[model samples]
Target: MNPTRSTFGLIFFTKKANENGECRIYSRITINGKSVDLSTKRIVDKILWNSAKGMARGTSKESLEVNDYLEQFRSGVVDAYQEAIIQQKPLTPENIRNAFLGQDEAAHPFQDLFNYHNEHEKQVLAKGTMKNYYTTQDYILQFLKKSKKPAEWDISQLSYKFIADFELFLRTFKKKDDPQPLNNNGVMKHLERFKKMINMAVTIEWLDKDPFVKHKLKFNSKERGYLSEEELALVETKELKTDKLMYVRDLFLFGCYTGLSYIDAINLTANNLMIGIDKEHWLITQRQKSAKPVKLPLLPVAAELITKHRHDPRAISNGTIFRPISNQKLNDYLKDLARECGIDKNFSFHLARHTFATTVTLANGVPIETVSKMLGHTKISTTQIYAKVVERKVSEDMQALRSKLSRKTVPDGEMIILK
Candidate 1:
């Protein structure tokens, strides 16, 4: 017996038509020709529903509303069919209908899938990534609470419209101590994480249809900021009066040379360094972000910094090259350091990774594939963002072309044709 085989239809209950000539629409679910009728509780005009197409016929508001309800009803029925098979229940039309209608005690329409992810996926996911997921969950709770409709946030009531509303809410939501709401990419990230959790539900047969299926995540392209070669040298060599400022500057410079994010850089222990294929020193660690293995030969400057701190009491005691520091405090010191050095941009600690990809590597003619590996990127496309922003690379290419075409200069306003 093919338990997966099933058919569904919609019909207008003309006999239940009210005085206004509007009839109730009912769902007909069939399993091996054994059928069951369930009331949809949606009223529509007598002639609006197209029985053959299993949908409403026209563009009127009532017809559109009826069509949306019918689609959700069908999705729930599909969910019911999967649930029935999973629990080894008898594959009867009535059993499926009961599950769809919440008459089955086993069916849970609003299972907390976000909570499920935290409990299960946390084991495999990095601690930093798990923290981001928790942030997404908190934002979702805020969205649901602000909706003020008890029924609206339920799993069964979710639709494309609901997704749109949630995105809007995230964009405009400003929590305490936050000066502004989430920017475009910030909003997209929350939705992307939420989509992953929703996918878990679909896999477990909790949701038959994904609301995010029709939604495409769009992140606006912004040119990443990186320090120039001169700026990096200035920051690296600057003498700070305070030990804390000096400490933050060195940590930031280490990231610039190695392309490790803030978390990966601080968590690095002495064991991460090893002899490479060339029999020279290399940094060997997996990126906490992508969990990709990073095996990059140490640059001279990076190796020098490691040697400079090799004998520090804190480094020896902690077994880490650099002890952990608060990200906020580091960024705070970095702002002062950048001002003192007369170099300016958004001087956050994470800017060091961008600096490594641009001025320290690509601008110096390093291969992009090699740079991608050093950075522990899963995709080369991510590293290409840095390459595009390297204006020096574009200028160098143009300069090489200028040298090749040195024979003659085109006269002013003279038209040149390609042969």
Candidate 2:
């Protein structure tokens, strides 16, 4: 009694007849003693059906045509079952029905699944992520049109060739909004979105195999720049003329201490601040981007900034721990601040996050694992990216080793020589 052993046959519903006294035909699939019925969309009069034979009583033209159609439908169902067996797919009635109806993911159109995935994900994904998914969809549509392919593609057609061609199109094709084509990582993001939809198809058994199995997504790692301690000190000490610039600077420094992104920083409230196990002030909040919890003990500088803003009328009225500022204006003021402070680098709010990871934490003797937790990183590997930027730490480590070796009477007995 192997569960995969399936039996299928065509049957007519003689009890349920229409006004014309015709009963609808159905195909029944049985697997592991379980059964399911699928409509064949064909009908015949009760008098013409032969229950024992499981077909219409035949001889006349109409009867012969009905019998022939039934035979063909039965053959298709049997073929589907045989194919499932050959492929070693789970032999389920629903799977067989999908196969017989040509609705298995291999025969199913890609657009349908893509749309379904997008619609389902809208409830759970962040707004920015949903925008990326939409953009990826648009890119796919554009590729199909440029290649003169059909609006609908079968799930089976999502081969390595298809992925390669789509990636090439993304690299070379220019959209109306921008003249430059997508960079490597940007292209990979779209492919990743496409892969997500395909995975969903596989999860539901709509697709028998993953087309992206052999295709590996490649990304170029760009240098993530952050302000050094000296540069940060300069920015902190600089006196700016405008109140707006001062406000932006304070907010930027707050991020540098807490490693919060602009969205997370602006969304913070008094409720998010809590006493930790050490009875010290802590920012206990969830990251807006990934909704992961972040528990960071407030450093002296970060605490001072929070106290400065605690009594601000705007913050009190807005019910936010800090007064809100648009990200664009913040970045614009950071650029001006960089020039005024003599820091020669592109300055943005996100750089504050990078600075926190490198200068504020790692270089200051904090473990990367602890820094990752404070930063609300779901993976330590993400925090490792910042670890690479701690060249000062590397130098200090080597220098400390050199100092220890120099102090040691390395064996007043033996002299070492370089190769």
Candidate 3:
């Protein structure tokens, strides 16, 4: 620690064993009593250190001010030493929440979010989710820097208008590398990430309330156009004829018939297919999006495709039904299939799942609830989005009901019109 510095240290002791090792090491740093790092200390100390140096070089009545600067420097040194003596590990969410319970009501929500995310990234969230959290934090920090505000400013000062304006900023904002503005969905996603971070803050008792409570997240409904039966047949014909691209197309189309997502489909193997309880039907027991195992009856078309690929070399070695292919590459191949099929709309891996829902199941009079279960949707509402595609079937159902309800001159006039 330097007497001219404006920083403190944060050290924690952890037990370690070696041939001749039992000593404490300075693990981290802080300012006052809050967490900081060595880089942050250098940043905070540079100006004050320069000012003290300038005062020391002066030649006037303010010569004694050098002593004052020296005392300030001494205070910083003492704080750093005391901090090291009392330092512990990086603060956890529970530690932060308990701290909040006793502190004055002026702490910044953003700091709370940062602290909570730090702990959660190491302990709870999946690796992919943690990476996204860091991305969201970066976006927010960049926006705040552009606004010329302190990084640790009070979040209570934030308003719904501020959040809305930040979203607008993201849309109109452009980097030198990308001159085009961010799209609506992109901006909404970043803002929603911020909201989720805030929600986490509230969950950890870091904030009294969530500032985003008043804001509604708006996202455009995506139009997922699956292939028609005719289009699917055309693809199948072209795929079965092609050698280089046949396997990819087959696996993708198999997914189309079975309503399997690309990830779940790729991970499926012979082991997943087994005899049902009745032993009359084969079943595919697989985990879908929510990690819930669902048992779907093996349809003939799906079964045939599986049988065809049963002898593939990769399947033999890896014991998985399909060779591993990246989702991006799989989607790229689907674009080729769409081009060959003369279909105009863009298609992707997920379209296979949508195709099974709209074309194979709902179009053939299967109940939406049954389709929802086969699709492994945790909620029926998620599957109901396909109802738009099943409008014709619903119309036919309504017409049939109307005809069945139409009475032919009942015994009493007006068919006794039940109350």
Highest TM-score scorer: 1
Model 3's alpha-carbon lDDT is 0.65
* TM-score: model 1 vs. ground truth: 0.73
Give one digit per residue, the lDDT tens place, for model 2 in 1-419.
24344455445444478888989776666776656656667888888988787787869887899889888988888898888888888777667777877664335676788778878998888776888888898888888888888887666545679889998998999867989988899999999999998899876656545779999989888888898888899899998999888988999999999999998898889999999999999999999778899999999999999999978999999899888787878899999988888889999988999999999999989988999999899999999875454789989999899767966956665666779
Model 1 bad stretches (over 4 Å): 1-111, 151-153, 408-419
* Tens-digit lDDT string for candidate 3 (1-419): 23234344433222232344422111233444544211111111121223323322344434445445444544554543544335642332223322323336436656666776778655755444566677777777787888887898656456678798788778788888989988877778888878877777655545544669789878877776787778778777773456546766787688778888787788787788888886744546655436666778777888889888877897778778776777778888878777776789777877888889998888888888888888888888988885345566767888787666665434434544568
The superposed Cα distance between candidate 3 and the true structure at residue 197, in angstroms, equals: 1.8
Superposed Cα deviation of residue 365, candidate 1 (Å): 0.8
Q: For model 2, what is the C-alpha lDDT against the true structure? A: 0.83
Candidate closer to the true structure by TM-score (higher is better), 2 or 3 = 2
Q: What is the C-alpha local distance difference test score of each model? A: 0.79, 0.83, 0.65
Better of 1 and 2 by lDDT: 2
TM-score of 2: 0.72
Predictions ranked by TM-score, top down? 1, 2, 3
Better of 1 and 2 by TM-score: 1
TM-score winner between candidates 1 and 3: 1
Q: What lDDT is reached at residue 5 by model 3?
A: 45
